[model samples]
Target: MGSVLKLYIQVAFAVKIVSCSITMVDNTTSKSPIDLSTAFLLRVDQSGQGDYKRIQEAIDAVPSNNSELFFIWIKPGIYREKVVVPVDKPFITLSGTEASDTVITWNDSGDIFESPTLTILATDFIARYLTIQNTHGNTGKAVALRVSGDKAAFYGCRITSYQDTLLDDAGRHYYSNCYIEGAVDFIFGNAASLYERCHLHSMAEESGAMMAQKRESPLENTAFIFLGGKITGVGSTFLGRAWGAYSRVVFALTYMSGVVKPEGWNDWGDSSKQRSVYYGEYKCSGPGANRSKRVTWSRSLTKDEAAPFLTKGMIGGRGWLRPSPTHFKKYQTS
Candidate 1:
């Protein structure tokens, strides 16, 4: 009887130890919620003890499948090179040392017949507080930021180019408090994107101000919705033009400058789009917000009609995602 009791006690103790061990392992291996604060900081001045000096190098060094929330903190300086964040690398954060101090300036446009300044093919990526520009001014299709991955976010970053400043190639993306400067078809692509509290600047030209969207699929209700943002441009720019026949875009509760053309939409030389594309606006204010005789195809959306497109769930439903503030803050306001 004594031996049996001792055995039972030992068994209970072993089980407890095993349970604790499993709990510790789970805690250590579980995905850490991404906050911009804990991500790595990349300083361009060669000051930190990080493994790499250049931002691209640092990004490359991260193990491809690293579940850890890796950050590349860029110090104050201009990084002049085309950067590609490929699909295999997810949960990577890129932020500047300071929003105003760090700059990623390059001179290649996708229209250069080959190169694009930045091509992001990774999901769960965040970029903040940096300037991404194609110094090759006025060049056609010069994409400063081309995002082709899902669950990507950009905050307080400046994306500048002449023709195609931002390419929302594919994905569900969030852009908040960022500045995008471009000319014809500047913000074009096939993504379901949301621009909240952003500034869209149109460079001087008669060729319309902003291009709201360019979605390709009828099955894909990909929409670009601008909320509480400002749109200003040079000469006269249409709010958007259909780069794809199935393009869908909306401007809601936005402040517009006179630069927005009354037509609100351009053909982009694709007449077939007139039948399929959907462009609309709601409660827009400013000299350019004139709705008189706006294109028959584009109209103002009712408040109820605009609700679904306004949230992050607009693209992928409720399980979509929430932006990582720490990661996003590192990149916002450039």
Candidate 2:
């Protein structure tokens, strides 16, 4: 009888696993972007099994203004701490064993300028195969990650929070195959950024807000391009809202879930922005692609109009960015 019960339990567990896998692959549930067990120069493990027990310790050890690639490998575990990559520590790479297991988290929510859990101010920096989370659930303006450095990239990482999950504050940046979760203005910034082959998951918030880009004017070299991604959430979602007069955001060849609202873009209660913001789309699909209901201010770009944004050159990355080594096939990573 015991053997029979054990067999039944095993079968039920296997069925549960199968159901979860199907849901994740169908994009109904958020999945780890990818698994990359890459080598690195430094290591962090809380079990005292690596070069250091703290991520910040490993980073603080890196030479200032270092020209070479200083890789720091963090093993599987939850690291509850705020981490900052200072301006002098250039060419730093913070990697993990895998995205689903390695976590760097903190619980703090305050003003946008002071609440980031992870701040990257160093140039030529890359973070991959891990998670950065602000654990202050439903708290005000908690930032999981913020990057204000030039030539930065994120690959196969997860930035999780409720509001303001990622502050792509300012830089020439790239995000490939990462999982980002938030409810309001989660992917907001004033940067030249390209998000390729990534996954955006929204929390179970009633008010759906995503992508609040701040670009003051047309000549400002900052814009956001999201390409070949999936947008999934529990509640209604807006593609973006103009945080500045000329906020620029484009979605190209992405799949959006039904949770996205038909209106597409918001003006933050200002009617004047409707005439100035540059919100455009090209070849986006799924339930959210109902362009007829989109705001008249939003645009459906022509093939020629989208050609510039479809390339990495849109962020002036050809001179510095390199291969992503993971999900993206054609474009460079960082």
Identify the leading candidate in terms of lDDT. Answer: 2
Model 2 spans > 4 angstroms off: 1-40, 323-334
Q: Highest TM-score among the candidates is held by which one?
A: 2
lDDT of 2: 0.80
Per-residue alpha-carbon lDDT of candidate 1 for residues 7-116, written as tens digits (9 for 90 to 100): 33432242222211111112234456544333433333355543456777767765566554655656567777788888888877677634566788787754532456
- lDDT of candidate 1 at residue 260, scale 0 to 100: 81
* TM-scores of the models, in the order given: 0.81, 0.84
Q: After superposition on all CA atoms, what RMSD does each candidate show versus the true structure?
A: 11.7, 11.5
Instruction: Please give, for residues 97-173, the per-residue lDDT of candidate 2 as tens digits.
Output: 57888899998899775788899998888887889999898858899999999999888899999989999999899
